[model samples]
Target: MLVSTRLGAARQIADEAALALRPEHPEYFSAIPPPDPKALRSDVGGDLSQLFLLLALVCLFIGAVGIANTTLVSVMERTAEIELGRALGARGLHITVQFLAESTLLGLLGGLVGTSLGMVGVVVVCAVQKWTPVLATRAEFVAASSPCRNW
Candidate 1:
Protein backbone atom coordinates (compact mmCIF):
# COMPACT_ATOMS: atom_id res chain seq x y z
CA MET A 1 0.00 0.00 0.00
CA LEU A 2 1.15 3.54 -0.81
CA VAL A 3 0.81 6.35 1.70
CA SER A 4 1.60 10.02 1.05
CA THR A 5 2.90 12.23 3.82
CA ARG A 6 4.51 15.66 4.07
CA LEU A 7 7.70 15.91 2.00
CA GLY A 8 10.17 16.34 4.85
CA ALA A 9 8.77 13.55 7.04
CA ALA A 10 8.24 10.88 4.44
CA ARG A 11 10.87 8.42 5.69
CA GLN A 12 10.21 9.08 9.37
CA ILE A 13 6.49 8.74 8.89
CA ALA A 14 6.89 5.52 6.96
CA ASP A 15 8.96 3.97 9.77
CA GLU A 16 6.65 5.21 12.53
CA ALA A 17 3.51 4.09 10.75
CA ALA A 18 4.96 0.66 10.07
CA LEU A 19 5.94 0.19 13.73
CA ALA A 20 2.55 1.36 14.94
CA LEU A 21 0.56 -0.90 12.63
CA ARG A 22 2.68 -4.03 12.71
CA PRO A 23 1.27 -5.39 15.97
CA GLU A 24 -2.38 -4.95 14.93
CA HIS A 25 -1.87 -5.96 11.31
CA PRO A 26 1.18 -8.18 11.32
CA GLU A 27 0.28 -10.11 8.16
CA TYR A 28 -0.24 -7.08 5.88
CA PHE A 29 2.83 -5.22 7.15
CA SER A 30 4.99 -8.33 6.79
CA ALA A 31 4.07 -8.74 3.14
CA ILE A 32 4.71 -5.10 2.10
CA PRO A 33 7.51 -2.59 2.53
CA PRO A 34 7.54 1.16 2.09
CA PRO A 35 9.60 2.75 -0.71
CA ASP A 36 12.25 5.36 0.03
CA PRO A 37 11.83 8.26 -2.33
CA LYS A 38 15.22 9.76 -1.56
CA ALA A 39 17.04 6.52 -2.28
CA LEU A 40 15.12 6.10 -5.52
CA ARG A 41 15.96 9.62 -6.62
CA SER A 42 19.65 9.12 -5.79
CA ASP A 43 19.82 5.90 -7.79
CA VAL A 44 18.23 7.51 -10.84
CA GLY A 45 20.54 10.52 -10.59
CA GLY A 46 23.63 8.30 -10.47
CA ASP A 47 22.51 6.43 -13.57
CA LEU A 48 21.93 9.63 -15.53
CA SER A 49 25.32 11.05 -14.49
CA GLN A 50 27.08 7.93 -15.66
CA LEU A 51 25.27 8.04 -18.99
CA PHE A 52 26.20 11.65 -19.54
CA LEU A 53 29.83 11.00 -18.60
CA LEU A 54 30.02 8.22 -21.17
CA LEU A 55 28.57 10.52 -23.85
CA ALA A 56 31.15 13.18 -23.07
CA LEU A 57 33.96 10.63 -23.32
CA VAL A 58 32.70 9.51 -26.74
CA CYS A 59 32.58 13.08 -28.00
CA LEU A 60 36.14 13.76 -26.80
CA PHE A 61 37.34 10.62 -28.54
CA ILE A 62 35.74 11.66 -31.82
CA GLY A 63 37.23 15.15 -31.59
CA ALA A 64 40.69 13.70 -30.96
CA VAL A 65 40.37 11.36 -33.94
CA GLY A 66 39.34 14.25 -36.21
CA ILE A 67 42.30 16.35 -35.08
CA ALA A 68 44.69 13.46 -35.69
CA ASN A 69 43.29 12.93 -39.17
CA THR A 70 43.72 16.58 -39.99
CA THR A 71 47.31 16.53 -38.80
CA LEU A 72 48.12 13.43 -40.87
CA VAL A 73 46.60 14.98 -44.00
CA SER A 74 48.52 18.20 -43.47
CA VAL A 75 51.77 16.28 -43.07
CA MET A 76 51.10 14.24 -46.19
CA GLU A 77 50.30 17.30 -48.29
CA ARG A 78 53.44 19.08 -47.09
CA THR A 79 55.82 16.16 -47.64
CA ALA A 80 57.86 18.06 -50.27
CA GLU A 81 58.20 21.10 -48.02
CA ILE A 82 59.30 18.90 -45.12
CA GLU A 83 61.88 17.18 -47.33
CA LEU A 84 63.25 20.51 -48.47
CA GLY A 85 63.57 21.71 -44.87
CA ARG A 86 65.47 18.52 -43.99
CA ALA A 87 67.81 19.02 -47.00
CA LEU A 88 68.44 22.61 -45.77
CA GLY A 89 69.98 21.26 -42.53
CA ALA A 90 66.76 21.29 -40.42
CA ARG A 91 66.90 18.43 -37.89
CA GLY A 92 63.99 16.05 -37.23
CA LEU A 93 63.29 17.82 -33.90
CA HIS A 94 62.96 21.18 -35.70
CA ILE A 95 60.47 19.80 -38.20
CA THR A 96 58.54 18.11 -35.42
CA VAL A 97 58.37 21.33 -33.39
CA GLN A 98 57.24 23.29 -36.42
CA PHE A 99 54.31 20.92 -37.01
CA LEU A 100 53.51 20.89 -33.32
CA ALA A 101 53.41 24.69 -33.23
CA GLU A 102 51.13 24.82 -36.24
CA SER A 103 48.80 22.23 -34.72
CA THR A 104 48.72 24.12 -31.41
CA LEU A 105 47.78 27.36 -33.14
CA LEU A 106 45.04 25.61 -35.10
CA GLY A 107 43.67 24.05 -31.92
CA LEU A 108 43.71 27.39 -30.11
CA LEU A 109 41.93 29.08 -32.99
CA GLY A 110 39.29 26.33 -33.22
CA GLY A 111 38.67 26.40 -29.51
CA LEU A 112 38.18 30.16 -29.42
CA VAL A 113 35.90 30.23 -32.46
CA GLY A 114 33.81 27.27 -31.26
CA THR A 115 33.36 28.72 -27.80
CA SER A 116 32.41 32.14 -29.17
CA LEU A 117 29.87 30.69 -31.58
CA GLY A 118 28.37 28.51 -28.86
CA MET A 119 28.01 31.44 -26.47
CA VAL A 120 26.50 33.62 -29.17
CA GLY A 121 24.05 30.87 -30.09
CA VAL A 122 23.00 30.56 -26.47
CA VAL A 123 22.53 34.30 -26.14
CA VAL A 124 20.52 34.49 -29.34
CA VAL A 125 18.22 31.70 -28.26
CA CYS A 126 17.76 33.22 -24.82
CA ALA A 127 17.01 36.63 -26.29
CA VAL A 128 14.41 35.25 -28.70
CA GLN A 129 12.74 33.29 -25.93
CA LYS A 130 12.75 36.22 -23.49
CA TRP A 131 14.87 34.20 -21.08
CA THR A 132 17.80 35.46 -19.12
CA PRO A 133 21.14 33.85 -19.88
CA VAL A 134 22.78 31.99 -17.03
CA LEU A 135 26.35 30.77 -17.46
CA ALA A 136 29.30 29.94 -15.26
CA THR A 137 32.31 32.11 -16.04
CA ARG A 138 34.76 29.41 -14.96
CA ALA A 139 33.20 26.85 -17.28
CA GLU A 140 33.27 29.28 -20.19
CA PHE A 141 36.89 30.11 -19.55
CA VAL A 142 37.82 26.45 -19.42
CA ALA A 143 35.97 25.75 -22.66
CA ALA A 144 37.77 28.58 -24.42
CA SER A 145 41.24 27.77 -23.05
CA SER A 146 41.45 23.97 -22.91
CA PRO A 147 43.30 23.67 -26.23
CA CYS A 148 46.27 25.68 -24.95
CA ARG A 149 46.73 23.35 -21.98
CA ASN A 150 48.34 20.80 -24.34
CA TRP A 151 51.37 23.04 -24.68
Candidate 2:
Protein backbone atom coordinates (compact mmCIF):
# COMPACT_ATOMS: atom_id res chain seq x y z
CA MET A 1 0.00 0.00 0.00
CA LEU A 2 2.98 2.27 -0.57
CA VAL A 3 3.76 4.12 -3.80
CA SER A 4 6.86 6.10 -4.72
CA THR A 5 7.60 8.14 -7.83
CA ARG A 6 11.16 9.40 -8.35
CA LEU A 7 10.49 11.96 -11.09
CA GLY A 8 8.25 15.01 -10.81
CA ALA A 9 6.53 13.96 -14.06
CA ALA A 10 5.83 10.55 -12.62
CA ARG A 11 4.34 12.20 -9.56
CA GLN A 12 2.04 14.18 -11.85
CA ILE A 13 1.07 10.95 -13.63
CA ALA A 14 0.32 9.29 -10.28
CA ASP A 15 -1.72 12.30 -9.20
CA GLU A 16 -3.82 12.10 -12.36
CA ALA A 17 -4.31 8.35 -11.90
CA ALA A 18 -5.46 8.95 -8.27
CA LEU A 19 -7.91 11.59 -9.42
CA ALA A 20 -9.33 9.21 -12.05
CA LEU A 21 -9.96 6.60 -9.34
CA ARG A 22 -11.38 9.04 -6.77
CA PRO A 23 -14.93 9.15 -8.17
CA GLU A 24 -15.26 5.36 -8.20
CA HIS A 25 -13.99 4.98 -4.66
CA PRO A 26 -15.71 8.13 -3.38
CA GLU A 27 -13.89 8.93 -0.03
CA TYR A 28 -12.32 5.51 0.51
CA PHE A 29 -9.03 6.06 -1.38
CA SER A 30 -6.48 8.88 -1.55
CA ALA A 31 -3.02 9.54 -2.91
CA ILE A 32 -0.17 10.96 -0.80
CA PRO A 33 3.31 12.10 -1.89
CA PRO A 34 6.42 10.41 -0.60
CA PRO A 35 8.56 12.58 1.64
CA ASP A 36 11.61 14.50 0.37
CA PRO A 37 14.55 13.00 2.26
CA LYS A 38 16.70 16.09 2.25
CA ALA A 39 13.96 18.38 3.44
CA LEU A 40 12.82 15.96 6.13
CA ARG A 41 16.40 15.59 7.35
CA SER A 42 16.93 19.33 7.45
CA ASP A 43 13.72 19.82 9.45
CA VAL A 44 14.14 17.01 12.00
CA GLY A 45 17.71 15.76 11.84
CA GLY A 46 19.23 19.20 12.42
CA ASP A 47 17.38 19.70 15.69
CA LEU A 48 18.03 16.15 16.88
CA SER A 49 21.77 16.36 16.10
CA GLN A 50 22.10 19.69 17.89
CA LEU A 51 20.15 18.34 20.88
CA PHE A 52 22.48 15.31 21.19
CA LEU A 53 25.56 17.55 20.91
CA LEU A 54 24.25 19.75 23.71
CA LEU A 55 23.56 16.67 25.85
CA ALA A 56 27.16 15.44 25.34
CA LEU A 57 28.55 18.88 26.26
CA VAL A 58 26.48 18.91 29.47
CA CYS A 59 27.74 15.43 30.41
CA LEU A 60 31.38 16.44 29.83
CA PHE A 61 30.93 19.57 31.96
CA ILE A 62 29.40 17.54 34.79
CA GLY A 63 32.27 15.02 34.71
CA ALA A 64 34.98 17.74 34.86
CA VAL A 65 33.14 19.50 37.72
CA GLY A 66 32.82 16.21 39.58
CA ILE A 67 36.54 15.50 39.21
CA ALA A 68 37.44 19.00 40.45
CA ASN A 69 35.06 18.70 43.42
CA THR A 70 36.45 15.28 44.37
CA THR A 71 40.04 16.55 44.19
CA LEU A 72 39.19 19.48 46.46
CA VAL A 73 37.44 17.24 49.00
CA SER A 74 40.38 14.85 48.98
CA VAL A 75 42.93 17.63 49.63
CA MET A 76 40.78 19.08 52.39
CA GLU A 77 40.41 15.67 54.06
CA ARG A 78 44.22 15.08 53.93
CA THR A 79 45.05 18.16 55.98
CA ALA A 80 46.95 16.06 58.57
CA GLU A 81 49.06 14.39 55.88
CA ILE A 82 49.81 17.73 54.23
CA GLU A 83 50.84 19.17 57.61
CA LEU A 84 53.10 16.16 58.21
CA GLY A 85 54.76 16.72 54.84
CA ARG A 86 55.27 20.40 55.67
CA ALA A 87 56.66 19.48 59.10
CA LEU A 88 59.16 17.18 57.35
CA GLY A 89 60.42 20.23 55.33
CA ALA A 90 58.56 19.43 52.12
CA ARG A 91 58.09 22.72 50.21
CA GLY A 92 54.65 23.90 49.01
CA LEU A 93 55.73 23.19 45.39
CA HIS A 94 56.65 19.61 46.33
CA ILE A 95 53.26 19.04 47.98
CA THR A 96 51.47 20.50 44.97
CA VAL A 97 53.46 18.29 42.58
CA GLN A 98 52.79 15.27 44.79
CA PHE A 99 49.00 15.80 44.68
CA LEU A 100 49.02 16.49 40.92
CA ALA A 101 51.06 13.36 40.23
CA GLU A 102 48.79 11.20 42.35
CA SER A 103 45.68 12.57 40.59
CA THR A 104 47.18 12.22 37.10
CA LEU A 105 48.45 8.67 37.66
CA LEU A 106 45.13 7.50 39.08
CA GLY A 107 43.19 9.18 36.27
CA LEU A 108 45.47 7.79 33.57
CA LEU A 109 45.36 4.29 35.02
CA GLY A 110 41.56 4.33 35.17
CA GLY A 111 41.30 5.74 31.65
CA LEU A 112 43.57 3.07 30.18
CA VAL A 113 41.79 0.25 31.96
CA GLY A 114 38.37 1.54 30.99
CA THR A 115 39.37 1.98 27.37
CA SER A 116 40.78 -1.55 27.24
CA LEU A 117 37.62 -3.03 28.70
CA GLY A 118 35.49 -1.01 26.28
CA MET A 119 37.54 -2.27 23.33
CA VAL A 120 37.10 -5.81 24.55
CA GLY A 121 33.36 -5.30 24.74
CA VAL A 122 33.33 -3.87 21.25
CA VAL A 123 35.21 -6.87 19.92
CA VAL A 124 32.90 -9.29 21.68
CA VAL A 125 29.77 -7.60 20.32
CA CYS A 126 31.19 -7.33 16.84
CA ALA A 127 32.10 -11.00 16.86
CA VAL A 128 28.63 -11.93 17.98
CA GLN A 129 27.10 -9.87 15.17
CA LYS A 130 29.65 -11.02 12.57
CA TRP A 131 31.20 -7.60 12.11
CA THR A 132 34.81 -6.41 11.93
CA PRO A 133 36.22 -4.79 15.10
CA VAL A 134 38.03 -1.49 14.67
CA LEU A 135 40.46 -0.34 17.32
CA ALA A 136 42.45 2.86 17.86
CA THR A 137 46.22 2.99 17.46
CA ARG A 138 48.62 3.82 20.30
CA ALA A 139 48.74 7.53 19.45
CA GLU A 140 44.96 7.76 19.02
CA PHE A 141 44.44 5.84 22.24
CA VAL A 142 46.75 8.13 24.17
CA ALA A 143 45.18 11.20 22.66
CA ALA A 144 41.68 10.08 23.59
CA SER A 145 42.74 9.14 27.14
CA SER A 146 44.52 12.46 27.72
CA PRO A 147 42.11 15.25 28.70
CA CYS A 148 44.08 18.50 28.75
CA ARG A 149 44.00 20.32 25.43
CA ASN A 150 45.14 23.71 24.16
CA TRP A 151 42.65 25.94 22.38
Say which candidate scores most in lDDT: 1
Per-residue alpha-carbon lDDT of candidate 2 for residues 70-138, written as tens digits (9 for 90 to 100)? 778889999999999999999999999988887777666756775677667766777777776655577
- CA RMSD of each candidate after superposition: 6.9, 8.0
lDDT tens digits by residue: candidate 1, 1-151: 7777776776576656756778666556633335667898799978877886787688667766877788899999999999999999999999999988887787777767867887777767777777776655774655421221111
In model 2, how large is the Cα lDDT of residue 70? 72
User: Positional deviation of 112 in candidate 2, in angstroms?
Assistant: 0.8
Cα TM-score of candidate 1: 0.66
Model 1 accuracy (lDDT, Cα): 0.72
Off by over 4 Å in 2: 5-59, 138-151
